[model samples]
Target: MKLVEITLDYPYNGGETFCKQELEIAEKYFDEILLISMSGHIGEGNIRYVPPNAKLINARKARYEASVYLKSFFQLLRIRTIREIVFAKKKLRTKESMPQILKEIFIYYYYANLLKRVFEKEVIEDDDILYSYWMAAPAYYLSIKGKKALKVSRTHRFDCFIEECYQPFRREIIEGLDCIISISEAGKKSIEARLIPFTSCLSEKIKVSRLGIMKKSSATDFGGKSNKYFTILTCSNIHIVKRLDLMIKALEKINIPVNWIHIGDGELGEQIRTQAKVLDSNKYVKYTFKGVLTQQQIYDFYERNHIDLFVNCSDSEGVPVSVMEAISFGIPVIARDVGGNSEIVSSENGILLDKNITPKVLMEAIRSILLLDDDKYINLRKNAVRKYRECFMASENYSNFFEMLISMAKEK
Candidate 1:
């Protein structure tokens, strides 16, 4: 079966990256797969560019986003002074740029329209399943075209936690889709609460299907080698919701010899550095902002580095791929036990935290895990890899997931 996977960008953004890896894994199930992403950089490979469009300004921002993701992936570079940089760049040369709000709206609409038109023209010629990576505006448009074998929309995120969310608006288009998959149970719940009002007022269905990661990367996955003392590493964008500051606070409170390293860059990185400085660079605490190391380099770091634990402090998540990767290299996680986290760990694999959790509470949890003896540590490591094989092993999970879609397509 030919499956046309739709996404907002190329295999760059987190969701699209998931789709990209899914396609790689699903190849055995689907005869041919075509990708339709507006942030499709047909030119520089990964540099996201809005394919040709009537909305030039929106296209420009797409280019800028593609460039930023490339920088994020390559050198761990941050887009400091976005406006200043845009004015200076060769593309957006004028200082008098459109208001940020208007530009974003335009880009979203432009991408949706461009995708709708492109798919309408292309799918007429190909008979296949339509598996959308995320329930963005583009997904809504693509599902309506002609003769689709199976139309599946996967929910990786819901902007619905806040007022004036767009999730319901997006779902209005796919309430009757063949099958809709949610990344996390939490995400599926949100879809129910938010979309009930508009369910096509239709009699259709959706399902919650999880995505997995490569069992092993061509790049070695990182597992902190230092088991002499517990070392926890958080690999995520250093954003506010990540709550890295609280991790620092927990470290300051815990008497155990501990060090934490944050692997990605974002808006909150400098604040993290300053907080570390305030702790007198605590004797037991060492911090490294390793920027964005390549996947292989990260794996090598895992093999050589002395890390004992992986921690996810994100306030929200869609089953972090990074957590799976850490475990793939035999590192156990002490995540905030939220979202699909439990799907990753339990008493058998690793530890979880409270939702209204405090620093002192977390400090105690880490302390309990770290205090485990050599035998316990070895058992946890063994269990971590077992879970990876039993559950994640992306190569097979991907094939199974797409095969489900492919079979549905055949039935349709």
Candidate 2:
């Protein structure tokens, strides 16, 4: 079968490190592959771990035409435009960003036209597949036109959470697609529930497909740790949603000294740095902002260093790949119970805090792990490794997902 995968920006730039591995795994399932990305960053590195025979296309090059805008405006008017306008007023909190919504609508219309042109030019067959990386705007837009190819979309947190998008996400787009996959059970539930407005039977169309990580060669040794120094590691784009401030504040409240390591960078990098200095003034917390590191660099850090625990205080998430990476290396996680985090963390493997977590709650969770006896700590480490092997290992889950896709394609 031929596979045509679409992403906002995966193999073309930084972020979505797991996507590189996903693309590589997908290569084995299809004889021919074409990767389509809406946009990409130019500078640093190639993010795709694709096979040598695959092709790449950037759909972002679709030029903006006034005709396309006019067409999209009329299209929006026919489908939930009034509701979207109301949603924008209530959710966005500003009229200034309404233009952004219009811009997205235009982009989506442009992409649909672009895909139609690609189908005409490249001659996509009925048996070929169009797999969208996210079940949001792109998938919705792409499904607006073409139906010859089997359409599948993987719905992550942002797409599953309707409030995250200002415009009312038309479920008809998803309903028309052949299959919809969710990264977590929580996400699956949300997606299924959202479809009730369209059809009662549509819930069965959404399936839970957990994201996986490559297992480490050897599990991290839990025995040897410096009594004086405890290291807490977190990997994510430094953003307000990540709530890095909560982590810093929690560290400040803790009596035990901590070395906090952040492995990613973003617009909030400088703000986080400034806050880190303020917390480090009394010497209770020492922050190391490692900027952005490649996927190999992250694995190397896990291999060479003794990271005591992994922490995630994000406001929201799907299934976090960074958490999977940490547990694969036998590091216990302390993540807020939001989104799909509870799927990975539990009483046996790691700690889960309430969604509305404060510094006191976070500090307590951290101290509970830190103050555990050696045997208990080692047990947690063992459980972490076991969890990764059973649930999050790449070989098992990805292969099963690929087989499912092949079966679905044949049925179609």
Candidate 3:
């Protein structure tokens, strides 16, 4: 009857920009949609436009009161907590301290209990689809409480990477949800592997539903343009994992003229800026930092600019939408081969770098692209466009995703 979608700061801040396109598609299928924001930080920027049929619920402030923590302290005795403890002991490596594991377990149950309180107040029906954008507390809570509802959750980088982090009750969450939509095949495989240790037969429920962007009318042209400097572009939050500093260090060593443009800002913005200043002395390297831009603004930038390469040096990813966006414009990419990045970027379209890519390695990759013969470079651009049309086109991917959702809901 209705679809309830849970998200972290969607339609609020610049975060979760990918959700907007999916929501636009989802609104067409679901009669009534409830968009719930569970983020602690809200009202930072303009709230994104919501579909006419979708109702926005700002549950960002939803959390247990200090007194509620005392009252619900007995929740620690539950079987889920025991299972999480055992999972941590067996699966978690020495890098994760016992105290840290315990704290994560406590926080997991704390948020689960908090979501439980929030869900109790909502008027949900048996046939309504409960969709969580991430396999976090919302999905966990819905799986346990959403009786007869077609419960689904989309798993991405942080929530799905168990080997990288100690996520409490991953097995339990997988067991509870009816379907797990992974943004990449690698993510789906990771979830399946996590299920193996528990002898869980829920791998069939895990499916890969790649994220996409709307197709562009025209791809980037590689012909008949003379520019003073070879322009390079990178767009992502300037976080530690993003490794903007690595990109900067690489740019410093380049002998040829380059104009590096960075989009987006984060906690490491100032630090990255300081690191980028080192490039000023290198006449060969010029850089600019365009603070956070909306999705439209990014599209506009791609439309107006001549980007020779789009680079991502992130330590982890879920097939970054930025890459998809670049490929949509037929811009060749040079990204670290991590997560689902390899699935989209390859030798034909772009260069997939090693996960342990250093400044020198990145510089070499950039130089390789810049030095490609005009025919080879144009072919790469064409292949990039072909990849976008084949996999990352929003109309094709999201339509099939929502259609599947509608079919699943009808079965319920």
lDDT of each: 0.62, 0.77, 0.83
Question: How close is every model to the real structure, measured as TM-score?
Answer: 0.78, 0.90, 0.93
**RMSD list, candidates in order:** 10.0, 3.0, 2.1
Instruction: List residue ranges in candidate 3 displaced over 4 A.
Output: 60-64, 68-74, 77-79, 215-219, 224-226
Candidate 3 TM-score, true structure as reference: 0.93
Question: What TM-score number comes out for model 2?
Answer: 0.90
Question: Per-residue CA lDDT of candidate 2, range 384-408, in tens?
Answer: 8888888988877888887888888
Q: List the residue pairs that clash in candidate 2.
A: 11-48
Residue ranges of candidate 2 with Cα displaced over 4 Å: 40-47, 62-101
| Candidate 3 residue pairs in clash (backbone atoms < 3 Å) | none
lDDT of 1 by residue, 1-412 (tens): 4667676656444335455466556555645556665554435434332222211111223454554444334321224234323432333233333454234334444555566546555534334777667776555555554454666778775432212232223443455467767776766665566554445633236566777776344433333335555678888878887888878888886676777777887777787877767556567766677876655566777777767888887777767888888778777788886667778877776787776788888788787777777677767777888888888776777777776776776677
lDDT of 3 by residue, 308-405 (tens): 98999999998899999998888899999899999999999889988987899999999998888888998999999899889988877989998887
Off by over 4 Å in 1: 12-15, 40-108, 123-126, 159-165, 197-204, 217-228
| Ranked candidates, highest lDDT first | 3, 2, 1
lDDT of 3 at 376: 90
> Which model scores highest in TM-score?
3
